[model samples]
Target: MIVVIDTSSLLSLVRYYLPFDKKGVLFEVIKSKVSSGEIILLDAVYEESKFVGQKIILQKLDFLTDKGFLKENKVITKTDELIPLAPTRFLNMVKNQFVANPFQLKKLNESEFEVQKNRFMESADAKLIMYCQHLIKDNPEEEIYLVTEETPSANDLKLFKKIPAICGILGIPVITLPQLLEKYPEVDLGFS
Candidate 1:
């Protein structure tokens, strides 16, 4: 299984699941999986996480990158063959969700919402979806999962389309931190 993790999901793990007593066990396991090429950390996610300035998150990410576990963004050379042109239906859905959602506008204001929506269009979430699609295209037998803490809003006017919603639209498999933990129950964090 190749688990593609995003910044928010990684931060959630660090903040909630990482054991205080056995400091590096969970991180080490993640690092090992990443080093073995079973896990993926996109370059964009790494850059965004660096700016978050959380000591533990930075440390873990640094360890992975330093150990060559972090991967550079995969360039889609045959994008036309692999995916539809820009302003695709998925892209339009993202844009429409942002534009029509009054809650999003109210919270971020029009200007700020536009900025954030643009950022989302270009950054981690979008890249993650593209990468997952590429992986599925190239290796249909391989199990690929996107790990994110983002959830869709029950309210009709959701300000932002979370990763799961986007992934659903793109046909990418998405899981949360708790779901990952539940699926991999053998993973010992030394919590006891």
Candidate 2:
């Protein structure tokens, strides 16, 4: 199984779950998942995370990203090489799916298509969906899940959709952090 994650979900880990454990249970559990290639974060989401937090959140992020950190001599995380941006067949997949799924880019005129494509190329939400689709196409038997802390709101329209809202539209399985932990009950982090 594979999981595609967004910035909000990672932030939720830092701000919500990790706070309950000064001993780094949650961090090690997630790091193990990442090391095992089960959880992949988009490059855009990674870049966004470094700058999108308040001071406390930023400090927590720093701790997560810090190299000199240690608990029982364990590393914080080895996520530096996990970005899927290089040799991104997913980019082509995104373009191909653009005309078909969620937004229906084919329905738009050339000018509008270009505008939408340019905008979506940089959206982490779109990257998450595209990564899911890309993996499904490459490996038919894969059960990929999209993870996000986002919930749908009334303004979650077709063009400007968030991760959870868009994943629903694209028929991808989306789950919250607690739901994900429940799905994999063995990965106990000492909290729901």
Residue by residue across 1-192, what tens digits does model 2's lDDT show? 888877788888777877876777666767777656687755667667767765444466454455554343342323333334333553454455333344465567878866876677556776677677667667778888888888865353454545665566566788887777676655665544
Flag clash pairs in model 1: none
Model 2, C-alpha of 90: deviation from truth (Å): 13
Among these predictions, the greatest TM-score belongs to 1
**What lDDT does the true structure give each of the candidates?**
0.67, 0.64
The alpha-carbon deviation from the true structure for residue 181 of candidate 2, after best TM-score superposition, in angstroms, is: 1.7
Worst 10 contiguous positions by lDDT, candidate 1: 73-82
Instruction: Compute the lDDT for candidate 1.
Output: 0.67
Residue 88 displacement (Å), model 2: 18
Question: TM-score of each candidate?
Answer: 0.71, 0.67
